[model samples]
Target: MNDETSGKASIRRELLASRALLTSRDVEDAAAALAASALELPELAGARTVAAYVSVGREPGTRALLDTLRARGVRVLLPVLLPDNDLDWAAYAGPEHLAPAGRGLREPDGPRLGPAAVLDADAVLLPGLAVDGRGMRLGRGGGSYDRVLARLAAAGRHPALVVLLYGNEVVARVPEEPHDHPVDAVVTPAGTRRFG
Candidate 1:
Protein backbone atom coordinates (compact mmCIF):
# COMPACT_ATOMS: atom_id res chain seq x y z
CA MET A 1 0.00 0.00 0.00
CA ASN A 2 1.74 3.14 -1.20
CA ASP A 3 -0.51 5.13 1.09
CA GLU A 4 0.99 3.18 3.96
CA THR A 5 4.48 3.73 2.70
CA SER A 6 5.22 7.33 1.76
CA GLY A 7 4.39 9.26 4.94
CA LYS A 8 2.45 6.92 7.17
CA ALA A 9 5.16 4.84 8.82
CA SER A 10 7.32 7.91 9.29
CA ILE A 11 4.49 9.63 11.10
CA ARG A 12 3.87 6.64 13.34
CA ARG A 13 7.52 6.48 14.26
CA GLU A 14 7.59 10.18 14.96
CA LEU A 15 4.53 9.88 17.13
CA LEU A 16 6.27 7.22 19.18
CA ALA A 17 9.41 9.30 19.53
CA SER A 18 7.36 12.33 20.51
CA ARG A 19 5.56 10.38 23.18
CA ALA A 20 8.88 9.21 24.56
CA LEU A 21 10.17 12.75 24.73
CA LEU A 22 7.05 13.89 26.53
CA THR A 23 6.85 11.08 29.07
CA SER A 24 8.56 13.24 31.64
CA ARG A 25 6.24 15.05 34.06
CA ASP A 26 8.08 18.31 33.37
CA VAL A 27 7.36 18.22 29.65
CA GLU A 28 3.70 17.52 30.23
CA ASP A 29 3.36 20.43 32.63
CA ALA A 30 5.22 22.80 30.33
CA ALA A 31 3.19 21.87 27.27
CA ALA A 32 -0.07 22.30 29.11
CA ALA A 33 0.94 25.70 30.45
CA LEU A 34 2.00 26.93 27.02
CA ALA A 35 -1.16 25.72 25.37
CA ALA A 36 -3.20 27.52 28.00
CA SER A 37 -1.35 30.78 27.40
CA ALA A 38 -1.89 30.63 23.64
CA LEU A 39 -5.32 32.09 24.24
CA GLU A 40 -3.68 35.37 25.14
CA LEU A 41 -2.28 35.88 21.64
CA PRO A 42 -3.48 39.13 20.19
CA GLU A 43 -4.95 37.31 17.23
CA LEU A 44 -6.77 34.83 19.42
CA ALA A 45 -7.73 37.21 22.20
CA GLY A 46 -10.90 38.53 20.60
CA ALA A 47 -11.96 35.31 18.85
CA ARG A 48 -15.19 34.20 20.41
CA THR A 49 -15.52 30.78 18.73
CA VAL A 50 -12.59 28.40 18.38
CA ALA A 51 -12.10 24.93 16.94
CA ALA A 52 -10.02 22.04 18.32
CA TYR A 53 -9.65 18.32 18.01
CA VAL A 54 -9.80 15.62 20.65
CA SER A 55 -6.24 14.39 20.71
CA VAL A 56 -5.46 10.69 20.68
CA GLY A 57 -2.38 8.51 21.02
CA ARG A 58 0.94 10.38 21.25
CA GLU A 59 -0.41 13.91 20.80
CA PRO A 60 -0.08 16.34 23.70
CA GLY A 61 -3.25 16.68 25.75
CA THR A 62 -5.57 19.67 25.31
CA ARG A 63 -8.08 18.97 28.08
CA ALA A 64 -6.56 21.51 30.46
CA LEU A 65 -6.47 24.29 27.90
CA LEU A 66 -9.98 23.50 26.69
CA ASP A 67 -11.36 23.90 30.19
CA THR A 68 -9.46 27.14 30.65
CA LEU A 69 -10.80 28.48 27.37
CA ARG A 70 -14.37 27.68 28.33
CA ALA A 71 -13.89 29.49 31.63
CA ARG A 72 -12.75 32.54 29.71
CA GLY A 73 -16.05 32.69 27.79
CA VAL A 74 -14.60 31.28 24.59
CA ARG A 75 -16.93 28.92 22.77
CA VAL A 76 -15.28 25.65 21.84
CA LEU A 77 -16.00 23.37 18.88
CA LEU A 78 -15.11 19.71 18.63
CA PRO A 79 -14.89 17.31 15.72
CA VAL A 80 -17.08 14.27 15.27
CA LEU A 81 -15.99 11.60 12.83
CA LEU A 82 -18.71 10.93 10.29
CA PRO A 83 -19.56 7.61 8.68
CA ASP A 84 -17.20 8.00 5.75
CA ASN A 85 -14.27 8.74 8.07
CA ASP A 86 -14.69 12.43 7.41
CA LEU A 87 -15.23 14.86 10.30
CA ASP A 88 -18.35 16.74 11.32
CA TRP A 89 -17.96 19.93 13.35
CA ALA A 90 -20.10 20.63 16.40
CA ALA A 91 -20.19 23.09 19.25
CA TYR A 92 -18.99 21.81 22.62
CA ALA A 93 -20.70 23.64 25.45
CA GLY A 94 -18.91 21.40 27.91
CA PRO A 95 -17.77 17.86 28.66
CA GLU A 96 -21.32 16.57 29.03
CA HIS A 97 -21.78 16.55 25.24
CA LEU A 98 -18.83 14.24 24.62
CA ALA A 99 -18.44 10.48 24.58
CA PRO A 100 -15.95 7.90 23.39
CA ALA A 101 -16.04 7.56 19.60
CA GLY A 102 -14.18 6.50 16.48
CA ARG A 103 -10.57 5.28 16.74
CA GLY A 104 -11.00 5.82 20.48
CA LEU A 105 -11.17 9.57 19.97
CA ARG A 106 -13.75 11.58 21.93
CA GLU A 107 -16.41 13.46 19.97
CA PRO A 108 -19.39 15.64 20.65
CA ASP A 109 -22.68 14.00 21.67
CA GLY A 110 -25.20 15.96 19.62
CA PRO A 111 -25.89 17.40 16.19
CA ARG A 112 -23.06 17.98 13.72
CA LEU A 113 -22.63 20.60 11.05
CA GLY A 114 -20.84 20.81 7.72
CA PRO A 115 -17.28 21.95 7.06
CA ALA A 116 -18.53 25.48 6.58
CA ALA A 117 -19.29 25.69 10.26
CA VAL A 118 -15.80 24.51 11.10
CA LEU A 119 -14.36 27.21 8.91
CA ASP A 120 -16.33 29.72 10.92
CA ALA A 121 -14.04 29.10 13.88
CA ASP A 122 -11.45 31.73 14.75
CA ALA A 123 -8.64 29.26 15.26
CA VAL A 124 -8.14 25.56 14.61
CA LEU A 125 -5.88 23.41 16.78
CA LEU A 126 -4.79 20.56 14.52
CA PRO A 127 -3.70 17.21 15.90
CA GLY A 128 -0.79 15.56 14.17
CA LEU A 129 1.78 12.82 14.56
CA ALA A 130 4.58 15.28 13.82
CA VAL A 131 5.10 18.86 12.75
CA ASP A 132 8.05 20.78 11.35
CA GLY A 133 9.16 24.37 11.77
CA ARG A 134 7.64 25.02 8.36
CA GLY A 135 4.18 24.23 9.81
CA MET A 136 3.67 20.99 7.84
CA ARG A 137 1.36 18.62 9.71
CA LEU A 138 1.54 14.85 9.51
CA GLY A 139 -1.87 13.49 10.45
CA ARG A 140 -2.72 9.83 11.04
CA GLY A 141 -2.88 9.03 7.31
CA GLY A 142 -6.68 9.47 7.28
CA GLY A 143 -6.58 12.77 5.39
CA SER A 144 -9.71 14.02 7.15
CA TYR A 145 -8.18 17.24 8.44
CA ASP A 146 -6.22 17.81 5.24
CA ARG A 147 -9.46 17.67 3.26
CA VAL A 148 -11.30 19.94 5.65
CA LEU A 149 -8.53 22.52 5.84
CA ALA A 150 -8.09 22.51 2.07
CA ARG A 151 -11.75 23.27 1.54
CA LEU A 152 -11.53 26.10 4.04
CA ALA A 153 -8.40 27.54 2.44
CA ALA A 154 -9.84 27.35 -1.07
CA ALA A 155 -12.67 29.61 0.04
CA GLY A 156 -10.22 32.28 1.29
CA ARG A 157 -11.33 31.77 4.89
CA HIS A 158 -7.96 30.96 6.39
CA PRO A 159 -8.28 30.21 10.05
CA ALA A 160 -5.18 30.21 12.19
CA LEU A 161 -3.94 26.63 11.98
CA VAL A 162 -1.99 25.68 15.13
CA VAL A 163 -0.25 22.39 15.83
CA LEU A 164 0.12 21.23 19.44
CA LEU A 165 3.04 18.92 20.08
CA TYR A 166 5.53 17.89 22.68
CA GLY A 167 8.69 19.96 22.48
CA ASN A 168 10.81 17.28 20.80
CA GLU A 169 8.10 16.52 18.28
CA VAL A 170 9.33 19.52 16.36
CA VAL A 171 11.38 18.28 13.43
CA ALA A 172 13.47 19.77 10.66
CA ARG A 173 10.92 18.89 8.03
CA VAL A 174 8.11 16.47 7.40
CA PRO A 175 7.22 14.62 4.22
CA GLU A 176 4.36 16.36 2.49
CA GLU A 177 1.71 15.21 0.07
CA PRO A 178 0.09 17.39 -2.52
CA HIS A 179 -3.02 17.44 -0.36
CA ASP A 180 -1.38 17.88 3.04
CA HIS A 181 -2.65 20.82 5.07
CA PRO A 182 -0.09 23.38 6.25
CA VAL A 183 -0.57 25.02 9.60
CA ASP A 184 0.04 28.66 10.49
CA ALA A 185 1.92 27.99 13.72
CA VAL A 186 3.31 25.30 15.97
CA VAL A 187 2.75 25.38 19.76
CA THR A 188 5.11 23.46 21.96
CA PRO A 189 6.35 23.73 25.55
CA ALA A 190 9.12 26.09 24.51
CA GLY A 191 6.76 28.73 23.07
CA THR A 192 4.66 29.62 20.03
CA ARG A 193 6.25 30.27 16.66
CA ARG A 194 4.83 31.27 13.30
CA PHE A 195 5.30 29.11 10.26
CA GLY A 196 5.16 29.72 6.55
Candidate 2:
Protein backbone atom coordinates (compact mmCIF):
# COMPACT_ATOMS: atom_id res chain seq x y z
CA MET A 1 0.00 0.00 0.00
CA ASN A 2 1.00 3.64 -0.47
CA ASP A 3 2.27 5.73 2.43
CA GLU A 4 -0.98 7.72 2.73
CA THR A 5 -3.04 4.52 2.77
CA SER A 6 -0.78 3.00 5.41
CA GLY A 7 -1.00 6.12 7.54
CA LYS A 8 -4.79 6.13 7.36
CA ALA A 9 -4.95 2.46 8.33
CA SER A 10 -2.86 3.14 11.42
CA ILE A 11 -5.03 6.05 12.46
CA ARG A 12 -8.27 4.14 11.81
CA ARG A 13 -7.03 1.30 13.99
CA GLU A 14 -6.54 3.62 16.94
CA LEU A 15 -9.82 5.46 16.43
CA LEU A 16 -11.80 2.24 16.11
CA ALA A 17 -10.23 0.88 19.27
CA SER A 18 -11.14 3.97 21.25
CA ARG A 19 -14.64 4.11 19.83
CA ALA A 20 -15.20 0.46 20.70
CA LEU A 21 -14.53 1.30 24.33
CA LEU A 22 -17.61 3.53 24.60
CA THR A 23 -20.49 1.95 26.51
CA SER A 24 -23.97 1.50 25.05
CA ARG A 25 -25.18 4.41 27.14
CA ASP A 26 -22.44 6.60 25.73
CA VAL A 27 -23.49 5.75 22.17
CA GLU A 28 -27.18 6.34 22.96
CA ASP A 29 -26.55 9.75 24.53
CA ALA A 30 -24.30 10.78 21.71
CA ALA A 31 -26.98 9.74 19.23
CA ALA A 32 -29.52 12.04 20.82
CA ALA A 33 -27.05 14.87 21.13
CA LEU A 34 -25.90 14.39 17.55
CA ALA A 35 -29.46 14.61 16.28
CA ALA A 36 -30.08 17.80 18.20
CA SER A 37 -26.87 19.37 16.98
CA ALA A 38 -27.30 18.28 13.36
CA LEU A 39 -30.96 19.27 13.13
CA GLU A 40 -29.96 22.85 13.78
CA LEU A 41 -27.73 22.93 10.73
CA PRO A 42 -29.21 25.00 7.87
CA GLU A 43 -28.25 22.38 5.34
CA LEU A 44 -30.64 19.89 6.88
CA ALA A 45 -33.36 22.44 7.44
CA GLY A 46 -33.29 23.52 3.84
CA ALA A 47 -32.92 20.10 2.35
CA ARG A 48 -35.91 18.53 0.63
CA THR A 49 -34.15 15.23 0.05
CA VAL A 50 -31.40 13.72 2.09
CA ALA A 51 -29.34 10.60 1.54
CA ALA A 52 -28.47 9.12 4.94
CA TYR A 53 -27.61 5.81 6.58
CA VAL A 54 -28.37 3.53 9.50
CA SER A 55 -25.87 3.55 12.38
CA VAL A 56 -25.00 0.03 13.40
CA GLY A 57 -22.50 -1.37 15.86
CA ARG A 58 -20.51 1.35 17.70
CA GLU A 59 -20.57 4.03 15.01
CA PRO A 60 -22.05 7.36 15.93
CA GLY A 61 -25.76 6.56 15.94
CA THR A 62 -27.87 8.12 13.20
CA ARG A 63 -31.23 6.64 14.27
CA ALA A 64 -32.35 9.67 16.22
CA LEU A 65 -31.41 12.05 13.46
CA LEU A 66 -32.99 9.91 10.78
CA ASP A 67 -36.26 9.62 12.64
CA THR A 68 -36.29 13.33 13.43
CA LEU A 69 -35.81 14.24 9.81
CA ARG A 70 -38.53 11.88 8.69
CA ALA A 71 -40.89 13.25 11.30
CA ARG A 72 -40.28 16.73 9.91
CA GLY A 73 -41.32 15.61 6.39
CA VAL A 74 -37.90 15.40 4.84
CA ARG A 75 -37.61 12.59 2.28
CA VAL A 76 -34.87 10.42 3.75
CA LEU A 77 -32.96 7.81 1.76
CA LEU A 78 -30.75 5.06 3.13
CA PRO A 79 -27.94 3.12 1.53
CA VAL A 80 -28.24 -0.48 0.37
CA LEU A 81 -24.76 -1.92 0.01
CA LEU A 82 -24.09 -3.52 -3.33
CA PRO A 83 -22.00 -6.64 -3.57
CA ASP A 84 -19.05 -4.66 -4.95
CA ASN A 85 -19.18 -2.17 -2.06
CA ASP A 86 -20.93 0.55 -4.07
CA LEU A 87 -24.25 1.74 -2.62
CA ASP A 88 -27.75 1.59 -3.98
CA TRP A 89 -30.43 3.59 -2.20
CA ALA A 90 -33.99 3.06 -0.96
CA ALA A 91 -36.47 5.27 0.78
CA TYR A 92 -36.55 4.98 4.56
CA ALA A 93 -40.17 4.36 5.57
CA GLY A 94 -39.40 3.98 9.27
CA PRO A 95 -37.28 1.99 11.66
CA GLU A 96 -39.81 -0.85 11.39
CA HIS A 97 -38.96 -1.25 7.71
CA LEU A 98 -35.31 -1.91 8.32
CA ALA A 99 -34.09 -5.48 8.00
CA PRO A 100 -30.72 -6.85 8.90
CA ALA A 101 -28.45 -6.91 5.90
CA GLY A 102 -25.03 -8.39 5.43
CA ARG A 103 -22.10 -7.22 7.55
CA GLY A 104 -24.43 -6.43 10.49
CA LEU A 105 -25.86 -3.36 8.75
CA ARG A 106 -29.53 -2.43 8.64
CA GLU A 107 -31.19 -1.34 5.39
CA PRO A 108 -34.56 -0.20 4.21
CA ASP A 109 -36.84 -2.86 2.77
CA GLY A 110 -38.47 -0.51 0.29
CA PRO A 111 -38.05 -0.51 -3.44
CA ARG A 112 -34.47 -0.20 -4.60
CA LEU A 113 -33.48 2.96 -6.33
CA GLY A 114 -30.59 2.98 -8.74
CA PRO A 115 -27.24 4.04 -7.30
CA ALA A 116 -27.53 7.28 -9.25
CA ALA A 117 -30.39 8.29 -7.00
CA VAL A 118 -27.95 10.00 -4.66
CA LEU A 119 -27.37 12.64 -7.31
CA ASP A 120 -30.85 13.92 -6.53
CA ALA A 121 -30.15 14.56 -2.87
CA ASP A 122 -29.81 18.02 -1.41
CA ALA A 123 -27.52 16.64 1.26
CA VAL A 124 -25.75 13.40 2.16
CA LEU A 125 -24.77 12.09 5.59
CA LEU A 126 -21.58 10.06 5.33
CA PRO A 127 -19.94 7.52 7.60
CA GLY A 128 -16.25 7.92 8.34
CA LEU A 129 -13.49 7.13 10.79
CA ALA A 130 -12.24 10.72 10.84
CA VAL A 131 -12.11 13.97 8.96
CA ASP A 132 -9.18 16.39 8.97
CA GLY A 133 -9.33 20.11 9.71
CA ARG A 134 -9.44 20.80 5.99
CA GLY A 135 -12.48 18.46 5.62
CA MET A 136 -10.60 15.58 4.06
CA ARG A 137 -12.42 12.47 5.30
CA LEU A 138 -10.99 9.11 6.28
CA GLY A 139 -13.70 6.59 5.48
CA ARG A 140 -13.85 2.98 6.74
CA GLY A 141 -11.93 1.77 3.64
CA GLY A 142 -15.08 0.27 2.12
CA GLY A 143 -14.90 2.67 -0.85
CA SER A 144 -18.70 2.92 -0.83
CA TYR A 145 -18.89 6.62 -0.05
CA ASP A 146 -15.93 7.18 -2.30
CA ARG A 147 -17.99 5.87 -5.19
CA VAL A 148 -20.94 7.97 -4.09
CA LEU A 149 -18.86 11.13 -4.06
CA ALA A 150 -17.30 10.29 -7.38
CA ARG A 151 -20.73 9.74 -8.89
CA LEU A 152 -21.93 13.05 -7.53
CA ALA A 153 -18.95 14.84 -9.00
CA ALA A 154 -19.33 13.10 -12.32
CA ALA A 155 -22.96 14.16 -12.50
CA GLY A 156 -22.14 17.76 -11.49
CA ARG A 157 -24.05 17.55 -8.27
CA HIS A 158 -22.75 19.31 -5.16
CA PRO A 159 -25.01 18.27 -2.34
CA ALA A 160 -23.93 19.28 1.14
CA LEU A 161 -21.73 16.44 2.38
CA VAL A 162 -21.75 15.81 6.10
CA VAL A 163 -20.19 13.35 8.53
CA LEU A 164 -21.42 12.58 12.04
CA LEU A 165 -18.74 11.57 14.52
CA TYR A 166 -17.60 11.94 18.07
CA GLY A 167 -15.76 15.19 18.89
CA ASN A 168 -12.36 13.51 18.96
CA GLU A 169 -12.89 12.18 15.43
CA VAL A 170 -12.68 15.74 14.21
CA VAL A 171 -8.90 15.64 14.14
CA ALA A 172 -6.01 17.84 13.12
CA ARG A 173 -5.23 15.86 9.99
CA VAL A 174 -5.97 12.72 7.99
CA PRO A 175 -4.04 11.55 4.95
CA GLU A 176 -5.74 12.73 1.79
CA GLU A 177 -5.69 10.60 -1.32
CA PRO A 178 -6.62 11.72 -4.83
CA HIS A 179 -10.04 10.07 -4.59
CA ASP A 180 -10.85 11.54 -1.19
CA HIS A 181 -13.47 14.28 -1.21
CA PRO A 182 -13.70 16.99 1.43
CA VAL A 183 -16.91 17.13 3.43
CA ASP A 184 -18.86 20.38 3.61
CA ALA A 185 -19.39 19.89 7.34
CA VAL A 186 -18.82 17.63 10.33
CA VAL A 187 -21.42 17.13 13.07
CA THR A 188 -20.40 15.72 16.43
CA PRO A 189 -22.09 15.53 19.81
CA ALA A 190 -20.22 18.69 20.69
CA GLY A 191 -21.14 20.79 17.62
CA THR A 192 -20.87 21.18 13.88
CA ARG A 193 -17.90 22.48 11.90
CA ARG A 194 -18.06 23.59 8.27
CA PHE A 195 -15.40 23.77 5.57
CA GLY A 196 -15.10 24.90 2.00
TM-score of model 2 relative to the true fold? 0.99
Number of clashes found in candidate 2: 0
Candidate 1 per-residue lDDT over residues 87-152, each given as its tens digit: 788877677777998688888887777767877888888887678877888777777887788778
Global lDDT for candidate 2?
0.95
**How much is the lDDT of residue 179 in candidate 2?**
93
What 10-residue stretch in candidate 1 is worst by lDDT?
18-27
Give candidate 1's whole-model lDDT: 0.75
TM-score quality measure for candidate 1: 0.87
Q: Give the Cα error of residue 63 in candidate 2, in Å.
A: 0.4
Among all candidates shown, the one with the greatest TM-score: 2
What C-alpha lDDT do the candidate models reach, one value each?
A: 0.75, 0.95
* Candidate 1 ranges with C-alpha deviation above 4 Å: 1-8, 17-31
